[model samples]
Target chain A: MNDTTPNSYRTGPDERGRFGIFGGRFVSETLMPLILDLEAEYEKAKTDPGFWAEMDDLWTHYVGRPSPLYYAERLTEELGGAKIYMKRDELNHTGAHKINNVLGQILLARRMGKTRIIAETGAGQHGVATATVCARFGLECIVFMGATDVERQKPNVFRMKLLGAKVVPVTSGRATLKDAMNEALRDWVTNVENTFYCIGTVAGPHPYPAMVRDFQSIIGKETRAQMMEREGRLPDTLVACIGGGSNAMGLFHPFLDDPEVRIIGVEAGGHGVDDRMEHAASLTGGRPGVLHGNRTYLLQDADGQILEGHSISAGLDYPGIGPEHSWLHDMGRVEYVSVTDDEALAAFQLSCRTEGIIPALEPSHALAHVAKLAPTLPRENLLVMNMCGRGDKDIFTVAEALGSKI
Target chain B: MSRIDAKFAALKAEGKAAFVSFVMAGDPDYETSLAIVKGLPAAGVDVIELGMPFTDPMADGPAIQLAGQRALAGGMTLGRVLEMVRSFRVDDQTTPIILMGYYNPIYSMGVERFVAAAKDAGVDGLIVVDLPPEEDDELCLPANAAGLNFIRLATPTTDDTRLPAVARNTSGFVYYVSITGITGAASASAARVAPEVDRVRKATGLPVCVGFGVKTPEASAEIAGVADGVVVGSAIIERIAAGEDTASVLAFVKSLTEAAHGA
Candidate 1:
């Protein structure tokens, strides 16, 4: 991997959608033409003023953009260190940052004249977000969830059903996010005619990883403007949880050229990184390999078979991170860290107690890292953590984790 | 010349479309799968697509996926798959065998070394579903260099701009996915497949063989009328997965091949 200069991070996935040696379209021939078509449509859509116009309009009116960058004053005082701020994307419609990318991709799907929408979701946050847009557009929507996730994340499943989208439970492999993604890819390859795969993160084959990153970059773009308007400069550090690294890419892409700002990505260290089969910390615990299209950091056995990743946060239970995250980690531009489930649970409760805000377990991993990083920094230094999702869907899981019956 | 080239040439002289049969290696067990494969040519199968089962098969439907699971459960490693091919080669040498699966196992085995071992195993071609033309440098080029034909799949969506790319590094024959979906997800219509076969045939001189969604003898006959070869995978594997003996499975395959040849 070459050194990432200040200006280099903005332009990723060259023509063939490669980030260094990662992020190419590693798919079967059936899906290759579809991926290429998506690439062409995205290329035109990125430049089309009308496309952005519709997307911005939806962002402001429907999906709720410019999610507040709130000063976590009480939490900062409790931590007693660098002033902490939260990019409260949980305040967005559908209650998470997921809607940002969902809205953008749905609009593109509509532009491409695709009438059907399908997606894979783990925590069901992305599923609910996709179902919301499909409902708005009256497109036929199907969300594939792991059978295990369907059982555990029941509230979001109900929400998807209420929104009139069919949630298919994928029973293959380990039956989690990775299996759900595999099933969704199968669906995409099978129904390439009218179906548009609304991938929930900055992963998958080409155009998806880069395109989703561009859509979700609204978080970083908004943070840049919001922070400047408030603090007159970029934050000292930017932090976001990395499942497939969509939220982190969204929060970090804009600041990559900002030399003074440090970027940190927190991966779900379920149990611990040393617990080989029990963590989703791909960058921290895995070697580079291929899965779900892109060649990225993957948790696999010696025979190259993908291992099921365990995480308390379903959203972070994928075996691989995005290819761009792999590139960034290799380039030493973004510091990748892992926070265990116990640490995340502690941070989850800490946020609710101190800031009166309930954070989803995914971002609680990021918060756990922030808690450690913030205290050591000088008091004047600024820190921004992406509170990417709300905790409403996680109440049951949290209760169970805390040993309280909900 | 590669066995695939010679087989196509022989089929052309005989005025018949090639009949290709697919079965997951080590399905039910290595010995059964080897028996099924070794019996294919005599059963009228022109070429054999031996499935190298992997942990994740994103392009296959339920039947093929289950077959892969059974194969993996039967201890079907890459070495075991090569062993199956080598065992098949011990008795027969004319029929072309293509190792078909995702790229991970081959990659895990190291690309050049895997290609060398595959050639040594009498493997004639490869159909790695995940390694597209964009990733030719990964395995396609190495396999081709090692005297193994790297067959590429041309789908309905491969437009004029993309066809050239998909056709560039392609050898052996172009495997035309009859439907726009995964293997065995939907029935293929000859009416929809005929023009696609024509389109791909125009761009590349390599024989176009159609697969995916082809199950019945009638479907194979219909597809055979339009394309150079008709490939049947999930149907054959379904019979094996149902615990059909080798003779019964070979008889069923002979019926499909006769129907194709009759076309």
Candidate 2:
């Protein structure tokens, strides 16, 4: 693998949708035409001002975008090092960064005349966002959630149900995000005529990793402007949690070429990144293998059977990272680290007490990394971490972890 | 000619469709699965599609999925699957053995090494469900280069514009998915599949084998009459899942093969 830096890292996933050797359209013949059609539509949408106008309008009004990049005064003082700023994407409608990509795909689906929207969710944040959009548009929504996740993320399941979406609990494999995605793909192959699969993360086939990254780039685009406004320059560092790495990709893509802005992505280190295979840190512990229509870093056995990844955060429980992140990791452009579940739980409480922001466990993994890094860095270092999700849905899980009654 | 092409040619000469049976390697247990596989040829099977068990089989239904789980639980690995093929080849060389599964396993064992090992283990063809024509360079070209037939599937969604692409690097028989859904979800109608089989055969100029929903002997006969071959996977797997002894499973397979050959 070549570690030489490219002139520009953003022009990736060439015509065949490959980010180096990571991403490609590795789907069945049944879904090839639909994927190709979707790609063509997305290419057209990229050039259409009308599409962006609609997206901008929806972002401003419905999703409440240009989400505030709040200075973490108390948290910074506690760390006594870098000035911390949180890009408050958890404040978006449906309470996560997932809606940013959901809206983009839903609009494209509308353009393509698809009325039935299907999605696979891990933490149910993506399901809620997809359900919310489908309700607003009166589109039929079906969310495939891991049966295990459905139990843990009960509140988000109810939120999706209240939004009129049918939540199908998948019981395949380890019954987690990967299995849910498998079920969703099966549904797409079965219902090729009218269904639009709104993938929740920056994984999956070619156009998906790229398309989701483009839509979620709004976070980084806004952050670039917001940081310039607040600090009179770009932030010195950026950090975000990665399940499929959508939020991290969103916040990091715009800064990839900047060279000076250090970027870090935290993966769920369930117990640890040791040989136990009890972690969701794909780039850190896994190797390249194909799953869910793309070749990326996958936690698989020596025989190539995908291993079930463990994580306290349901959203960070996936066994693979985005293909682009794999490419970026290979290129040495982004530093990928992992935090254990115990560390993340502590970070969750710290964020709640110090910053007065109850962070979702997904981004709590990121905050845990920030906590470790902030204390060592100089106070002048401007560190921006993506608060990609709110914690209301996770209060139960957190309380249980804390051994306290909710 | 490759074993797959030779078998198809022989079947064409006999004016009979090939009876292709799929079973997960090492399902239930390695010994029982091996016994069942060895019995397939005498039971009238023409081609064998040995499933290389994968952890995530998105295209498969409950029956095949459970079969894979059983196989994995029995400690089935890619190396062991190849060993099973090698064992099968010890007695039967005429029957085409195709390793059917996702790309990750073969990819995990490196494409070049896998293609070499599969070829060495007497694998005649491959049906990796996830690898479409767009990503043919990953495994298809290499496997084809190593004298193995890299088969491709042509689904109902594969339209006129996409048929040529799907068939371009394809060897062996083109698998025509009889339904739009995963395996074992629905039964296929020959009336519905016949025209689609004709389209794929014409486009690819190769034999078309219909699969995905062929469940019963009658269903197998109906589909065989329309296409060059009939593949029964989940149905055979269901019998295995039911814990039928190797002999009983072979008896069931023989019945399905008889219907296809008699068609």
**Largest DockQ belongs to which candidate?**
2
Clashes of 1: 1
lDDT of 1 by residue, B110-189 (tens): 88888999999899999999998989999988887888899999887788888888889788899998777788878778
> A27 in model 1: Cα distance from truth in Å?
2.1
Across B1-263, the per-residue lDDT of candidate 2 in tens digits comes to 88889899999999999999999999998999999999999999999999999999989898988889999998999999999999999998798999999999999899999999999999999999999999988999999899999999888899999999988988889998988999988877889888898898899999999998888999999999999999999889998888899889999999999999999
Q: Write the per-residue lDDT of candidate 1 for residues A309-400, one digit (tens) a residue.
A: 88999999898999999999998989999999999999999999999999999999999999998989888889999999999999999999
Off by over 4 Å in 2: none
Off by over 4 Å in 1: A3-7
Per candidate, native contacts kept equal: 0.74, 0.88
Model 1 native-contact share: 0.74
lDDT of 2 at A332: 92
Best by lDDT: 2
Determine which window of 10 residues in candidate 1 chain A has minimal summed lDDT. A1-10
Provide chain B TM-scores across all predictions: 0.98, 0.99
Model 2: lDDT to the true structure? 0.93
Cα lDDT of model 2 by residue, A286-378, tens digit: 999999999999998898999988999988989999999999999999999999999999999999999889999999999999999999999
Query: TM-score for all predictions?
Result: 0.96, 0.99
